[model samples]
Target: QFDRKSQEYRALKRYWKLIQQDSRKLSDKRFYRPMFRMHLTNKEILEKLLSYSDELRQHYELYQFLLFHFQEKNSDHFFSLIEQEIATVNPIFQTVFKTFLKDKDKVLNAMELPYSNAKLEATNNLIKV
Candidate 1:
């Protein structure tokens, strides 16, 4: 309905060029596919992206999702998300995440979850009951 017009917007338009370069892309078939070739240091670059602004903190989830599909060794992106999500953690969160990360195979287990899906599911089940 509306449009953006400004110098920052113009410069930021550049990120759109390679935005699709993210290792994860959706195929025409609506399935997921991973990219194999990526320039080195991409991981560091993605990490640096988070360092830019606190307002962008909300995007950490998207960064991790992309890394899972597109990156094999971009530790920067992975660690950056961890640092952002955990940096200001309270004592309860700190202890819970410390234990959660102990097992990497439990992928659905989330350390930074603000809303527990389990609780949501339980609420739905209660309504059904």
Candidate 2:
């Protein structure tokens, strides 16, 4: 871990936004080319930041899993396991989990189903308007 007052800690704070961004959306040249201004690629920055702490690495892995693996058949089970595992990792995660638990069935269904009712909801809203 880095000392809170160190230059490395400040750099980590500056780039913290990158941690939650979807990697696929960042594949475009325009999206990633700006990192060159600092002479550090996104991958390199993430590697350096993640290397600082085991919990941060685990959090990153969990975020990636939530983004990419939610469509799998066993996703619901995995999601529950992840919730349990991260229960002590961070308080923010626990808050998010509580929100998900409120709509747990709907959340699981969204993960399992390929199609969404978004269009239907939009049409309903249009009709109401």
lDDT value, candidate 1, whole model = 0.45
> In lDDT terms, how accurate is model 2?
0.71
Per-residue lDDT tens digits for candidate 2, residues 1-129, read 678888668767788877877655543223343433555566677776777788888888877777776635567665776667656758898777677777778887777778888999999999999
Model 2 error, position 21 (Å): 2.3
Q: What TM-score does candidate 2 get on C-alpha atoms?
A: 0.61
Q: Return the clash pairs for model 1, or none.
A: none
lDDT of 1 by residue, 5-108 (tens): 64334433434333334534422232221221333344433333444545443444454453573245444454455546665655565565465456433433
- Shift in Å, residue 115, candidate 2: 5.6
Which candidate achieves the best TM-score against the true structure? 2
Candidate 2 wrongly placed segments (more than 4 Å): 1-5, 23-38, 71-74, 113-129
Highest lDDT among the candidates is held by which one?
Answer: 2
Backbone collision count in every prediction? 0, 0
